[model samples]
Target chain A: MSITPFNIPIVPKLKKETIYSLARKGSRIDKRKLDQFREIKITLGAAGKAHGSALVELGHTKVLAGVKIEPGRPFSDMPDQGVLNVSAEFLPIASSEFEPGPPDENAIEVARVVDRALRESQAIDLGKLAIIPGEKVWVVWVDINVLDHDGNLFDASMLAAMAALLDAKIPQHEILEDGSVRIIGPPIEPLPVKKRVVSVTIGALGNVFLVDPSLEEEAVLDTRIMFSFDEEGNLVGMQKTGAGWLDWDKVAIAFNIARNKYTVPLRALQGAFKS
Target chain B: MSGKKPPFPLLKDGKRHDGRGPMDLRPIQMKVGILHNADGSAWVKMGRTEVIAAAYGPREPPMKAMILPDRAVIRFRYHMAPFSTDERKSPAPSRREIELSKVIREALEATILTHLFPRTVIDVFAEVIQADGGTRTAAITAASLALADAGIPMKGLIAGVAVGKVEGQLVLDIDQVEDEYGEADMPVAAIVGLRKIVLLQLNGVLKPDEFLKALSMAWEGLKRIYELERSVLGSKYKGV
Candidate 1:
């Protein structure tokens, strides 16, 4: 009945030393290069009942994304466009640190980051979701559930959300004589997705940087930066976390790393859609 | 009949709507240890209904009061996704879900050797990703496998099935249509090898003789499910 704060476990000193030494050798604890990612497996339509859904496993981290669309009144200011609401729940059983109850700060942050990446990059064509001028529109809700926490959740969650959106279908409807709408048929049209966005996390330890750090690596890292890129390699959003700061040079380097390797996850996501 | 015509002829020429016989269960597909983060997990599909279950623990209880001195406390959470039904459901636990969770926990607890791990809790989470009725039975079946996949000690595997009376005919494994329009529904869960029922819930109406017939039909369906569960576990843990 009570809520508790999530506590990040401390890594052993020897393991930290080993990670630092590995960084000096341009390697990682997982034996990947500085900019390499772990194996990613994605399954679309995993949530068979959702309009669109995907299960993404970035290494050991697992996240399930489900998209539901319903007819509702559009916002007063954005009457011409539909709305997108993104929420993430860290299931208590996913990890020992996560507690049961409502979404905590970490869950909210993940949801907002994924939401901003998709919204800012125009991933879904909101204008096309409009059913009427400003009175009615399809409100798309993307819910992310973290089933496992092995680190690099931001990238995994973003990929899951994107895959779910791409796999979504809009329900067929008929306008009634009273000007109300009725879903007359099953989902018939795919959601209008205009752009593809992929996020990559870069972890920094002293002067060395690494990509897709695992939970163990994250426990000892000094700082980490996440970059979201559109298909054209344009930076759409970024979030910097950890107590340490990254200089401009490091920031540019991180951006370049993301630009060059963003295709890895994007291609993986697209591959899931095709299957 | 309350002067209301039944929704379509549920049975024709001795065959049910889905071409199944009176005692034939819907096709089932099951996989164990499908999730990496959980100690044990399983995915199951029965007809059009799909459910995934994950088991965690024998670890320390999150709340001090939940710890049991003589055995591990079993906590079950059954969730039907917002999109799991024809109409979108709210992403909140409902009364139905709460009751199902309690029954599922009790059903699983009958087989799990919780006394082996004292002062701890075993968490079982079942999610109905898709529903065409009988989701609770499907979820319980999957959760049983998940607990086994988690390598928890148990006396025997548990299997579940639902039997109902539709259009005055006893049928095995009612689909969504029959669930909404049928005259009676009875879901039963039992320890597979021991043939002991741990959970049973009845709704609607049925005479004593009809109830007995439904129970026997459910037993037959559960036996087949138990075999499937064994095969799945055997194939996954062949060498170990």
Candidate 2:
């Protein structure tokens, strides 16, 4: 499909060679530790119209997430639970290669990965969102828009979505005598969130595994593996992407590095709420 | 789909719901060059799940803009027939299908020597005729065989499987029942010859140690599938 990424050229040979050579030397182009991540900063309430919103910047990459909660029909299978819809748009404005249109595989991948993290962790207690059992429940929508493309959009978008979900408030509503809901002006109750989760992406180049790659570093990456963890250190989700392969041992190493460094983003999420 | 768990335990004594042990895999069957007019094709059946994969091209790309200077572009799509499931699924591609297509492509790309055929497109389409569970893994196994049948140069073959937790037990080659009721499911694909994992995804909750156990089990499962794939290819070549 045109929505999928195709025909994209690999990074320039010279740059790829330089990165590979540096990796062979156990050094990086940006001089950060192999396991180090770029600086991360998150801003909550970036969108006023949204029930919850966050803007996240990781190095030069920027992502905005907004949450809108509305009373609506629930899925047939999950009649008592709320519906969580996470979508992402990779606007052309973010990068020259990112065309404006429907969401592509990359965007879908991001949204699905983010969605899995939240759902698996039981971050939101969906059963609590029921307005009328099996008929009506709250629908929580998370729309993530990429403003700039640098690298590690996965981590940035998840961070933004989590922060937004945490900051979200549900509108007041009540059931009438006939099970119809009465309208309410503004939201007051916090979403029934029970856990905090963040994902870590580790990009590999031969023997060297780099955490939270930059745009330049990402172009030459052989493969990348990501893991999501809850605040209590429970492993929630895992995904491996890119064209390269990794041995099982290397995956273990990546997992350990992720387990240790995940606190970086979790702390950033907590710090956002404190201030 | 009903989220209600079946009243019976998924596993009793040492037998799973299907009468297999926890480590037992559903029976597998495969055939190569099954479809006409395709450069290469394969049909694979694992348990009740059935999938067919076809590979075409390494020829000129349909769009001039799609030609790359370095390596051939690989386009992949994983689809399920409307009647593949108990319920009639929409023919339109869902987000899950889209994601699976991308992930399966990335996994197969690791084996293809794309640089050998530049400025072209290598197309692979995997269609599921039945959906039992682990269709993506079955599709990967079938696609790899189709590519091999097409005579594409490759570093190695790929085999895929999923290990999941059901009833607090770590089970190999999860089926639809286990997948639906299980607490966690992780699908994995590997280039067993290279001892490298090319594709992996985890959904549901898995502790760290459990993750390692499930991965090791998946690797073991892949090894068996790889052997089956190799023998099938060898038999096909012999018949020709």
Backbone clash total, candidate 1: 0
- For model 1, the interface Cα RMSD in angstroms equals 25.3
Candidate 1 local lDDT, A1-275, one digit each (tens):
11111234546899989999999899988889988999999998899879999999999999999999999989886787888999999998789888899876567767776886787667889999898869889999999999999999889999999999998999889988877989888887999999988889988787788899898988888667777777877556665544333443344566677767899998897787676
Q: Write the per-residue lDDT of candidate 2 for residues A24-63, one digit (tens) a residue.
A: 7777888877888888999999999899999999999999
Clashing pairs in 1: none
Q: Model 1 chain A: which ten-residue window has the lowest total lDDT? A: A1-10
Model 1, position A241: C-alpha lDDT score: 47
Model 2 residue B75 lDDT score: 88
> Candidate 2, residue A183: CA error in Å?
3.4
Candidate 1 residue runs with Cα over 4 Å from true position: A1-6, B1-240
